[model samples]
Target: MVCVEEYAVRVLVTGGAGYIGSHVVRSLQGSGHTVAVLDDFSTGSRRRVGADVPVEDGSLLDTAFVEASLRRLSADAVVHIAAKKAVEESVADPLFYYRENVAGMQSVLEAMVSAGTRRLLFSSSAAVYGASATSPVTETSPTDPSSPYGWTKLMCEQMIRDVSLAHGLSWSALRYFNVAGAADPTLADRGESNLIPKVFRAISSGVRPQIYGDTYPTPDGSCLRDYIHVNDVADAHATVLEHMENADLCTVYNIGTGTGTSVFDVMTAVRLVTGVDFECDICPPRPGDPADVVADPAKIRAELGWASQYDLGSAVESAWKAWSDAPS
Candidate 1:
């Protein structure tokens, strides 16, 4: 299903060629929206953005370039998805995260203001919640992020809020959970930083996928996470954009299935989907890792009539097929 709106609007997606960005871009195209892409190609691809789509290759950090692109494309809305996203990498290099995520967001918003683009969809993360006391992290959860990456996301959210207040920009910040799976096989996550891709890499390399920790206090003694498909995430973006037509703006939403899946559970799904009876070894949990991280998507569902379509089995199955078939 395409996410193109009833009224034709020119939308520019920043980092529209990356893992999640590509899915959203395709959804926009399918829905009949006039879409353009602006990506630095740092960890993105021209193909993922679609060969026929208009793509402006440049850095989001360049305010002048971002401003020029928004003006040139006559963008009516901007979906900001370009940023540094690795949790571990952010820990090792907090300065880089601040420089890219926060500063880059500033550039995008300023450009939108310059071009008179009033609508926006900002890519946020569940990392902003850190370790929540509740089972299902809500939109109003305490946002005391433990890692620098989380801090960057939280800071960016604040920046977006401030920008909207000052510029009258209509925006939605979709705080994503453990985003997995693929809408298409070729667009399956190529970066191995994510769990699904990491497991696929291990299996293809003749190594057992390692469970970070099995000693956590959960049903399976492993960390439980809310894994949402890339397709569903894309769908949420489209739905929220539609909702903005005649509703309140500058709101935040948690994007997930509102259910928990353990690392062991995901491993089993990988085995089931791939038809490989592979064993996994348990290792110490990474620092700052929480026992359970789930979502309470009530706000988004009630507001936008959004619900996830893919279950764990379908998501894992599609992901394996994508990873297996995608060029190595």
Candidate 2:
């Protein structure tokens, strides 16, 4: 077992102004750690982070800027969360995905080496498992990503492992499932990318939400997914950081609730939360989408003592509250 250390440390969070990144910043700060943010704000918003947190506005592709920021902050660890994450967009433009997600990760690794920052907590994805994964996916599950986005995440995880072997960088890659909801209205997700927010956007525009597939082999015939709260995912990042020791440690864990909720169930939850009896359109199954992609969180629970505190209903409620309050 890797040794655990107890002390407050300064941490730099890349993409800290984004949805998940913002929550992570708050979680780390709540744990009494000094926190700073590094974001280009391409998809992130400055309003998500507090004024107390120092922001280093720049691109991670620029290794010099990232290195300078780490040196200036004297960071004890780095939480790398900056990456393009739209699966469809990645499929449309594989080159952009490789450059941004893959090359950008390399740049951060290089800057970490140059700046002498040893500790890292990477924001990986469950996409690495891709379609055909069994329900309740584990860390040891075979990685056969179906899309360019998942490929980039897998490549980045490998890079982190290789860097750890040579540079003695203590690291943990958290493969989180579908993250929904916000810590509060101010920190709400501003994008219309994922399922919950996409549905909210559709409803807000007076259009019925679209269910991609409804004839899967699930209990409800709709696809099942593990939707963990953004706050819980943020908390997992803090827990991994707190438990990391000063040794050359490389670890990976699945961050999720270990439960699957069908798409119809999510729509039902949305109606209950928003009190809107809006109907949904059933569409053909999306290519590469699995019938079920829930996480098997036993590893993180037993190893790091981390588990989700929010359920599907909680996620839908908070997401609706935030989306309803977001400005036009």
Candidate 3:
């Protein structure tokens, strides 16, 4: 609650049926904002998208659908969350990643301009700061994305800045760290790019959880990352959305807890929370994995008055509960 009034607006969230998008939509709706979803439904489904939320079943690449939807909803702002986000998948097929993530962003921006939607919150990623030179990455830290997926995010950030330079657009790019868990179990992350879901998938299959590359230079010889709950990520989205509306923002911020959790730390927490003791099988390191990446939220905290409320254990516990309850 940054304002005396809730600062409600008609928001259009792209990819609203997906995992992170769904939670963001929920957060926006809870804050008394009207919301509509535009999704292709390739990886997202109607069930995760609530019946109450209005939806336009279409692709972001299709400028016609995007323009029509923006005009139809008379959206006050747009939160661009639709992108292909898998590191390994991006490595395997870089062209597809570029075509979908980068090209789709272009289409969205064009549509927003066409529909007179000037405010936008772009879903950037910590992957933009690939590997880590500093322990706690600040907004001004050097960006050297090691993977194609990370590169796409960086490109989108540049696009936002360039677009704003040319057009009257107020935009913010929040570079997310690892987003996990859910506000509700039903809305828990279903994607397999993260540690929690991969651990769940492995353990449930009667195999030990696999930790890639235990030889990284870090405490306990494993990579460290900032794991923020999806709900907290969504809350940051709400905060940024309101912040964008109030002021001129052609800037970037890291969306993360100002702390780091190692892979081994997460495994222990998962075992403790699930009460299912399992060993971890250490494999070779992935190509682009950095030793560690933690966020310095000082800038965002002082400016936007935002911080992660949930701890890492709570996030893993919620995901485990959802994984256990759902049919795999």
Candidate 4:
């Protein structure tokens, strides 16, 4: 059992019933810290969270309810993970994305302020740097969000910074790039959208998997991305919580494997893992797809002493195992 140092403080995880959030909850519990989960079950499932933890079923947009919940729980720190995430969906409905991702973050910040919770670990995304110039983007890379979903994440980062400066809160925003694989077998059943899961589903069903735009400026003529195991991402969250007290206002870190793997490479790995060769259809590039996006994890390593345990092969293996073990 990987245990977090015994901290008597209680931690609250928003979107705790979701994939990444559920893993964070488990990590916290394993570390001997008490955890409370707040989720609306919009994209999250109640079954993902452990049966023992208290899960408040409500939306983060409900300010009063959020405030009441925080007050009642008397949480020591909050890990905000709930948000609208799909890039294409955000493009279709920017307003909905802003409402859920931006507005909901505001409500959570206000509630935390009211409840006297000054420490937070925000689950930010690398989408903020939509077509970044640097292959391995550092924390200081220019943020040129290309999609509505990315814009929402940037907006939330600004919110966290402002709140931290004004209210003397200590916060860390982890800009995650390609959070792939599953930590728990049960939670893996709820996986969606990510390239690994999509490919796994198609290969398992003996259907052709579609690969959009193969003529990109890469070795394999496919877009490149840094794939980080979900377990590593979860562990980084706990690391942030442990260092929250000493952290300055609003620190940011890039969480990734610091290596880029192309779509073709991923498919090749998938084929090797499943021992099943499937056809792949090449379609026009998706509207917001970037040519290459990786992360420079030096800041995270220096600041939190965090490192990824799984590489591309290990990541694909874990994801394959999760999908293989899941019930149909």
Task: Name the candidate that leads on TM-score.
Answer: 3
Can you tell me which runs of candidate 3 are displaced by over 4 Å? Answer: 2-6
Checking candidate 1 for backbone clashes, the offending pairs are 2-30, 2-31, 3-31, 4-31
Candidate lDDT (C-alpha), each: 0.86, 0.89, 0.89, 0.85
Q: Which residue pairs in candidate 3 have backbone atoms (N, alpha carbon, C) closer than 3 angstroms, thus clashing?
A: none
TM-score, candidate number 2: 0.96
Q: Give Cα distance to truth, residue 217, candidate 3, Å.
A: 0.8
The TM-scores, one per candidate, come to 0.96, 0.96, 0.97, 0.96
Q: Comparing 3 and 4 by TM-score, which wins?
A: 3
Candidate 4 TM-score, C-alpha based? 0.96
Q: What is the per-residue lDDT of model 2 for residues 1-328, given as tens digits with 9 covering 90 to 100?
A: 2222365788999999999999999998888788999999999998988999999999999999999999999998999999999887888899999999999999999999999999999999999998878878999998888889999999999999999999889999999899999878878886766899888888888999999888888998998899999989988987788787434448889999998999999999998998888999999986567778899999989977889999999999998888878655
Which residue pairs in candidate 2 have backbone atoms (N, alpha carbon, C) closer than 3 angstroms, thus clashing? none
What does the lDDT come to for candidate 4? 0.85
Clashes (backbone N, CA, C under 3 Å), per candidate, total 4, 0, 0, 1
> For residues 1-328, could you state the per-residue lDDT of candidate 3 as single tens digits?
5452658889999989888999999999888889999999998878788889999998899998899999999998999999999988898999999999999999999999899999999999999998755879999999999899999999999998889889989999988999989767667677878789999888888899888898788979889999999989999999888877668788888899988999999999988998888999989988778789999988889998998899998899988888777544
What would the per-residue lDDT of candidate 1 be over residues 1-328, giving only the tens digit for each residue?
A: 4334454578899989999999999887776778999999999976686777898999998899998998988988898998888887888889999999999998898888888999999999988888654679899888878778888888988988898899898998999999888877769897857888899889888998888888888998998999998999998887887767666588899999998999988988988999888889888877667778799999988977898988888888888888888765
Model 1 residue runs over 4 Å out of place are 1-5
